[model samples]
Target chain A: MWETVLSALMDPVNALFLVGGVAGGIVVGALPGLTATMALALMLPFTFSMSPEPALIMLGGIYIGAIYGGSISAILINTPGTPSSIATTFDGYPMTRQGKPEQALVTAAFSSGIGGVLGGLTLLFLSPALADLALQFGPPEFFWVAIFGLTIIATLSAGSLLKGMIGGCLGLMLSTVGIAPIGGESRFTFGFSPLQGGLDLVVMLIGLFCIPEVLAMVDRKRVAKQGLALKREKGVAGGVIKKLVRQPLLLLRSSIVGIITGIIPGAGGNIASLLSYDLAVRFDKKHKDYGKGRMEGVVASEASNNAEVGGSLVPLLSLGIPGAAPAAVLMGALLIQGITPGPDLYTRYPDLVYTFIIAFIIANFVMFVMAFYGARYVARMIDLPADVLLPMIVMLTVIGSFAIRNSYLDVCMMLGFGIAGYFLKKVGFEPGPIVLGIILGPIAETGLAQSMLLGQAEGGVWQIFFTRPITLVLIVLSLISLLSAVYIQTSRAGWKAGRRDAETCDAD
Target chain B: MRRRLNREIGVSLFFLGIAVIAFIQVEGLNRMSAVFPRTLAVILLVLSGILLVQSLVRPPEKKKGETPLASSRILPFLLILVLYAVLIAGLGFLIATILFAGVGTWYLCDRNKIRAIIGSILLGILFYALFRFVFLVPFPGI
Candidate 1:
């Protein structure tokens, strides 16, 4: 491991490309309406020319940089450049409003650096052990793991659990639009050649997330606000470092939340950041200051979101199941490099794995150095005029969308989704749930169907799933998640009623 | 605004109608095809039912006074898109993109003629050059 790390550090070309990739990713991510997925997709073609190690190193750099870069826009514009930065905006923008934009930038940078390093360390130590454990999992266990991922729908449901389930079912139904899995029978082609190929995940991702954002931005031409002249505090880095040291537990806990959520397939940085923010609020004694420009909120969110980069790789590297959307794209990169993910990855390519781990550690440190010096300049970007910024974003979104596969179909799909997403937002149905459902739907359906088939093949429908302890545990956990959601809704309703009665009594 | 909501309802119903048609189309297939689409159609039917019920239960709320785009604006945008789609394959990416960007910028930029012209030209040239020279992404030469 030490040798591999040293070798990776010594390679000048690898280091240069890594820095370049991080720079590119930061630019892509700092722009509103341009997501990390789009950045990865756009950069994929460039990777075709490079060797595998440098290519993977660059992609890893981009991944980490993009996740951290989103916080810049979130802090300044109140528009999260990526979904993962949504939690950061809760406190980050308020800090900007309070004329502490510099502090927010520094805090975010510091937390992101710490979180990224912690996540990388976790990946380094935990992955080999997890990979060893993954060897014990059979087809049934894999099916259960997929089912566990799908159960996230229950937690993510917005208005009604039923609607969320219907959305998930719709996604699953769409997944079956092309050829059948087991049998070679055509299902729903209806004579269209394109439909036979089914909807591309990248196209769907761009449409469902990016297009809607672009259309919304166009409709509401948000004028970028000029930066407030902050009173230059003594030692900005010292201040940020002092705060982090004061709240060591908060940083540690948020990073853990990020890593755990990231390791779970289907739940990515967005969910991880939100969950961590909630946990921070719960634990914070002075929670009243949370949304009112509290530095802790920004710290918790930035830390967790960046940490998810390393956490997300766990499942992707170990079980061949991508923990997040970007990881899914990275999985494609790995396959393109002729490296298959599974048990054999660690055994055969230990050097590559170790190199990636070391690159992550180095990338975090590089990110820290860049963000530390560059925060003020990056913050100044918030002042760019709306006319210039809007046009630039629109142009980038168009180019980024088109650059993926060089297909016009993708562009059209993006426009369609943008219009649809705008309406979905107006109606109070969040797009995150739908996007997550679409991603996890296929895995869930195939797993459930295969598990059932295996059961039937074994003479009884319930024997295989019920007899296995792990399968039984996962099924029970899924049931508990559903019941808990229902219970929470009911309790909230009851509490509202009690509060209403008390108010009436006081009025009387 | 009422007309817009009514139009949305009509569109959604049309999609629901397609779902039904698809369900019927797959009725004759073996057990595999029959199961998935039928399930999808049922789900779509239920969603449409919920949408219909929600529409009735709570009338579509309107913002204070912003007028829904007259069918005139809607028709033109749709026409522009459809025409671009038709022209893109035959006319090639460069010309089609230039025309599309020029027209789109002209329409979207609040009728600023100079900005529209310059923005469109710059976008077309910059994107074309970036893709063609820097990235070497092949665009069908027209």
Candidate 2:
């Protein structure tokens, strides 16, 4: 572990990718419409052709960086670049109104850095134990785990639960397009020979996530927003840091809130930050003072969101279950690298796992450094014309899909999915549950099928599936997840800041 | 503005069709392969069925003004994407991208011939070089 950490730190290429991911993620996250998930999806092609360590390193950096970057727009422009920073606007924008934009930015940056590192530490320490526990998961347990993931994401990620489940079923059907996982027979090819391989996960990812956003941006291009001016002030960051250092518990509490929220599959950073901000208000000496230019508000919101990044990765690394959408994309990256994340990940590739975690913590520091110095310039990226950004991203999707197999067919399929995804989004089907379904489909199918074969000897199918202690626990959890999502939707009149929407799901 | 289909009713019917198609298709597969898909097909059918029934029972929620980023150009933009993909197979990656980017920028956003021409050329060249050189990604066409 020490050797891997040292090598990751000492390597120039690793440092470069980590820094670049951080800077790029911050810019994308601050762009309001662009999200960590889309950024990760766009960055997917870049990773497929590279080795595992650097890919994981860069993705970790981007995840942490983008979560913090949302706070920048929240502060200056009164818009969250990503949904995760919606809470930041409460006090962050007020701070901007008070001529303390730079101070607020620094406060956010500092708290995010501290929160992110703490959260990464939690992942570094906790994932091994989780992996050990997951090693106990058999075919039945794994099947239930997949079901749990699909249920949680579907209900939490979409506005309409029925529609979300339909989307999940759609994704499951898409996953079946090529060969049957267990039977090894071509199932849904519909006589298209090329589809015998099914859709490329990366291609679908680029299509489903990127293309919809590009078109959506085009639709909104007419509604223009102007940014507020940012002035550089000396010692602004220094003052914010010194003040934040005095309230260690506040930062720790917010980060804890973020970590716990992140561990619950569908509760994303937006939820984490809101819950943290609420807790801060309850404990704050002047209870009614939050959302009125309180630095603690910005700190709590930013810290929890960034920390959620680390907290979210724990499940992805240990159980192959992504806690959020960005983590889902990260799982795709892991798949691209020929690494299936699960219990064996710790045993088989200890070096890559350790390097990724340590590099993740290091990326937060890099993000802090870049955000402190380059926040103003990065804010200017939101100004780039949608026409340019859209076309460029379209080109990226073309090349990104093409590069994976050097196949124009994949590009066309990507475009097809993009078009379908656009129409799907128009009708309120989000990419979150679809992506989850696609990821979990193979796992669930193989788990159940294999369990069926095992049950031939172990008495009966019900005994195999329902009799296990672990499977029972997972079944109960899946029920709870589905019920809670239903209750939350029915109880609340409106969803705020899209707690599990595409962007906020990656707000992890 | 053109009259639009009732989204709730329309989406439910569309998904219902998909569910039927999926279930019918699963019948031709081996029993082993069909089991899982068959299960999903039923789920889709039931879910879409529930959605349709619910849509009929409840009044569709009235949409508020300023539906975030609503636009009429999506269908036209999708046509552009199809054209772009087709052009890639014939025109080759570079030339196709140049035409797509150039025309897309000019009509879609820039609306300035000079800037569109220059910007598209620059973008086309930059991406061509990156894919051609930095990544060494092979383009299938000329």
Per DockQ, the best of the predicted structures is 2
What is the DockQ for all candidates, taken in turn?
0.27, 0.61
TM-score of 1: 0.81
lDDT of 1 at A208: 58
Q: What TM-score would candidate 2 get against the native?
A: 0.94
DockQ of 2: 0.61
Best by TM-score: 2
How high is the CA lDDT of each candidate model? 0.69, 0.83
lDDT of 1 by residue, B1-142 (tens): 5764775466456547756776877676655435545666787777767766666666566644443433344445445555655566678766676676667666656667787677767877887787678766555324
True contacts kept of 2: 0.60
| TM, chain A, every candidate | 0.81, 0.93
Candidate 2, residues B1-142: lDDT per residue as tens digits? 2123366777888888888888888786776688888899888889988887887777456554535333666667777789999999998989989888888888677478887899889999999998788867677467
* Model 2 global lDDT (CA atoms, 0 to 1): 0.83
